[model samples]
Target: MPITEKEVRKIAQLARISIDDKDICSYEDQLNKILAFVDEMKAVETEGIIPLAHPSEETQKLRSDKVSEKNQRESYQSVAPTTENGLYLVPQVIE
Candidate 1:
């Protein structure tokens, strides 16, 4: 389907774009080429190829689930400028 100026205008309006007369011609050619590419792609035959997330044939490494030592919060909070009841104090930024 060839992209029309009217269709471009309608799409631009929907997208809140401000395309002028000079840019419309350039955009029209671009859109027509993209539509032509899609038209060509529709002719290809794909019978058995499966669509996949990753193109490579490799499995991800698995890790064994085990309980680990938790991080020491008291040690980490020592770096903060101010702390009260295990909470970091921050300056008020909002009204």
Candidate 2:
């Protein structure tokens, strides 16, 4: 069904938009055209069409998961002000 000007105004009001009087007709026309296009699309036939995640059939190149850096925990903790059981101590700010 085609959208009416009154319905367009109501939609604008509900969406908290301030549309001009002349623009209501334009909005109504655009909305009606969209609905007509949707009606046309509904008539298309699609019996066994499968949906796809991507349009192209290319595979993504991936790298192997491996450790590339050496451990520096001891070197970092040596410079800390307070560390107990390999954990840094901080002043409590909340009660």
Candidate 3:
């Protein structure tokens, strides 16, 4: 599960990242540590554990679905340069 400088360089090429040649050893060490941590996590036991979407069991609270704002479409559209059939009109940009 250890990462090497060659592997790091290959990963950088695939990810389109520019890693400095001097930082290759640093990146290789960091990646190896991450891989070792993943290997440690793979050793965990979860036979009877149920996957959960959230940490808490309580459901989220919701607000009332009733309308709270008055309709002002006509008032707002009045200032438009051109509008037709309750819809705004725009000039053609492409042939």
Candidate 4:
């Protein structure tokens, strides 16, 4: 099903985004294309196909979880604009 302007607006609201008037039509078109692709996939009959983790059989690298260095808190905080109680202080926005 093609997504309409109202549906786009609803999706924007649900995603907590402010979609501008100029971008609403583009968003609707993109959403419709995505839905159409999904509909096309629904028409395929894959009864016994198994899902694979990766396309190739290459192995991934594993890393050790041990800490290699201590926290450079004092050194890093020395360059900050402001600091208090071992924390970087930033300007407050709200009253």
Best by TM-score: 4
TM-score of each: 0.44, 0.43, 0.45, 0.47
Worst 10 residues of 3 by lDDT: 37-46
Q: How many residue pairs clash in all the candidates, one count each?
A: 0, 0, 0, 0
RMSD of each: 9.2, 13.1, 9.8, 5.3
lDDT of 1 at 39: 92
Give me candidate 3's TM-score against the actual structure.
Answer: 0.45
TM-score of 4: 0.47
lDDT of 3 by residue, 1-95 (tens): 47778889999999999999999998898888888877876688988998787898788999899998899999999999999989999888789
lDDT of 2 by residue, 1-95 (tens): 78888899888989999899988888888899888888886687877888676888888888789887799988999999999888898988688
Give RMSD (Å) of candidate 4 vs. truth.
5.3
Any runs in candidate 3 off by more than 4 Å, and if so which? 45-95
Compose the digit string of candidate 1's lDDT tens values, residues 1-95: 69899999999999999998899989989999989988986687878877687887888888779758697899999999999999999888798
lDDT of each: 0.89, 0.87, 0.89, 0.89
CA displacement after TM-score superposition, residue 82 of candidate 3 (Å)? 32
Displacement of the residue 93 alpha carbon in candidate 4, Å: 12
